[model samples]
Target: MDDDLRERIETAAEKHALLNAVKHESDADVGAIMGPLMGENPDFRQHGGEIPGLIGPVVAEVNGLSNAEKRNRLEDLAPEELAEMEAEEEADDSLLPDLPNVEAYDEVRMRAAPNPNGPWHLGHARMPAVIGTYKEMYDGSFIVRFDDTDPETKRPDLTAYEAILDDIDYLGFEPDDVIRASDRVETYYDHARDLIEMGGAYTCSCSGEDFSNLKNNGKPCPHRDKDAETTLDEFEAMVAGEYSSGEMVLRVKTDIEHKNPALRDWVAFRMIDTPHPREEAESYRAWPMLDFQSGIDDHLTGVTHIIRGIDLQDSAKRQQFVYDYFGWDYPEVVHWGHVQVDAYDVKMSTSSIKELIDAGELDDWDDPRAPTIKSLRRRGIRGQAIVDAMVGLGTSTSNVDLSMSTIYANNRDLVDDETDRYFLVRDGESFAVEGGPDTAHPPLHPSFEDRGARDIPVGDAVRLESGDVPAEGDRVWLKGFGCVRRESDTLVHTGDDLDVVREGDVDVIHWVPTEGVQVRMRTMDGDVTGVAEPDFGDVSEDELIQFERVGFVRVDDRDDDETVVYFAHK
Candidate 1:
């Protein structure tokens, strides 16, 4: 091969090697870079035999530099390639399939009806993410409805009404309308009375055990044949607080011998003497069950589509009987199976998490250990990441086992370009370094040098985590500063040329000056104390940042005494 051809081959190999190294954070593979190198430079394919020999040294040189240096060199050598790589890494927000029969409806109105028992967890984000996506796709309205009617069992929390809305907003959705079922008790009562007069519902006074035995045998109770007037009177009496709790329950008439016995004569309304948490429903004792209330509200509010879990298929079956009685068309229903996240060993139950909080095991809804949406947001997870992760699951009915790494990957893409880099040595140990530069200039973000560099002042002594300290007689690179050789108790300055350290295979590590600012990072494992670069103090609260070689974190609190951050992911 001629000299010009060899130079072009080496240049192509170095570009691909630098890009691959920056991506994997490891040595570039000669095999992986070869295909892209030849593909991009078709002229080199004729000399494929000589290409590997010429490119091998170039790949080795590219792999020898630290991750930061690899990125810096890539930005300097082939900035357009770096930009193309980033564009490919950007999160694709169009993962969800189009809603079925979207053209059938004039407006695609949908609702996310979450029971306001507690704040929303990660599991609860799917409904809103899905519904919001459809709403945007069709230019329709999204309703935030609180299904908070069971005042006794799943008692409503007054504070959770706003908390749930706040979570929905954080997930990048704005409710076109907000409805509290507790405030609409009278509307449900009107529907209950109409259904009773229509001979579709009856008041059942059978004891719990007796009804269970009769229903198990596919036999009707004595009250099943009662006239509509008598049943309505009894229901009115129950609503008037004339009967104690569990004495009478309004049942929607259905087939007693249905294959799924749970669908037989399902309860519609029941008497609960326990006062509701909200004042609007405090005077009422009779409340509708979830299926009954949601069925009526869905139709009354003009909901054209329903998206829910497959486990609730029976809800659609039961509500169909009521829809038939009213001569109303049931909305289009889409069901998805349960999604299990591998990271959360704890049950993703609001009641269970509330128990933990009350027992003093968890700090609150925003605790780093909890799976609540607030916890995720507080841990530096972006709303867009959560939305994309949930929507990417699609509307398939098959149960999915997801890993948190999927979420972290999506989050890393969303945060990488914006978050500035800093150094934080956790459980740091001080070490003397003699004759180093007075100031070190590291790019705020290696990909975007236009953002400028952080002028971190260096001193004669520096600190690194205990595990990062080099053994005696070992040489290491003090990132962005210079190379040093550990001699006895101190690291003695050697040279500033990166090629020397790269050629010697010395480790490149991050460090903070002896007078660095204190930082306490809260991670899922536990709290870690450390020191960070002084420029870390300039970061505003809630800003996402990366600790040089450490993981990404969100600043929670910063003060002169101590700076607190939450570890997001590596």
Candidate 2:
């Protein structure tokens, strides 16, 4: 075959291999290559029998090159082909409408206010990508503000603060500033005092059930009528720790008959005696509620835009009351529907997940099965793929139900072009072969010549998967080698011509030398043990590789004897 035909076939093989990897296919079936190849080279439709002969050498050739070199060549030699592939990978952003008043601000300021109580999950992963895109669109500032004030419920972890920062950095965002609500409690307190003096809030001394009863009845509490002077004095005494927990709370004044019962006289501040991890222990018992604290912080931080879920519409309403009370303009609120990955049903709440983690139900925040960003990173999911997935969802107000496969699809497009290929044999069973070649060579990558090759010594005896032993008289091809017919534990050798097995429809399986290094792979469900090519023994920790016919895995641990990998996807 001519070099151009070989290159095109190699590209076709790589595309099919990547698609198979995305589908978690064990092997890139020859039939799989034909369809995509015919799309690029229509003439191949007529040369059906010769297709397999054309594929074997090209598959071997392209598998030797690094994913990066394959991509470069496609861009240089097959620009149109590469463009088509990229267009397929491009994110759909039709729902992400332009920001309101984009030209009104001197410089747009957007913030991702994640409460530093737990690591971020796929749902939370959307915030930075969405907010960062808005920031970049308007040449605005991207900020991270930790809303970590609810010590009793959504408790703060100092470690989670850095973990969130790392996640933000991983998503390719460099925040202009990082603000912690715990560090700005006094600022919120100041806003609270001003609101009390303005008669927009008051100190309520009613019990929880009593206030619930009155609120349910659409009646004001007895203390709701207290003058601003008396209420100010009561608040001062509560702030001085004179009032114990449950004895006092600050409630924002709103219409008692508001449509939403929770909105009628919402509690702005409450008492939480639990000592904060990062803040002083029980230094201030009275704390502002999320609505009050976030409302104050957003205004003071000069945030121009806020992107969050539709469930927070009530929060926006409550914060708007505070903004109106202070005669301040509310930031533009862009709310999207909640996104749930059907494959990932793990709790999205940091507090709940932290409880499980503390009880030892999970390995850590970065546990491969966990839904957190750290866990995704450990599983070999690329950050860019994450962004693409989120952006593809856009800012639609309609609910989105998806699966992990959506994210993996985007990831495969990226990782497939950069990852190298290797062979691995699982469920290995030994058998002695007669008359097979003494040595075999397979390209490290198929497309790049400089990637070199690995030599496998094909001795008389060979080990194959116990399940893959061909029936007597059946032909099988040992990858990188020619065909053989099964006869008991020995194989009758076939000619070296690639077409012999292609014409006979012989099954092909990957094999590793008996001397190949052992591997223990940690998959999403459990562990998969196998023997890999000796070339894999040199792979470093954190490097991603595709174990041909197995799956893509990230080297988690590399020792002198064996390697441990985290299975990313099929």
Query: For each candidate, what TM-score against the reference?
Result: 0.86, 0.84
**Stretches > 4 Å off in candidate 1:** 1-32, 35-94, 501-504
Q: What is candidate 1's lDDT per residue for 158-253, written digit by digit as tens? A: 899999999999999999999999889889999999999988899998999999999999999789999999999998997898888888999999
**Full-model lDDT for every candidate:** 0.87, 0.78
Q: After TM-score superposition, what is the CA distance of residue 314 in candidate 1 from its true location, in Å? A: 0.5
Total clashing pairs for each candidate: 0, 12
Location of the lowest summed lDDT over 10 successive residues in candidate 1 = 85-94
Model 2 residue 320 distance off true place after TM-score fit, in angstroms: 1.4
How much is the lDDT of residue 384 in candidate 2?
Answer: 80
What TM-score number comes out for model 2? 0.84
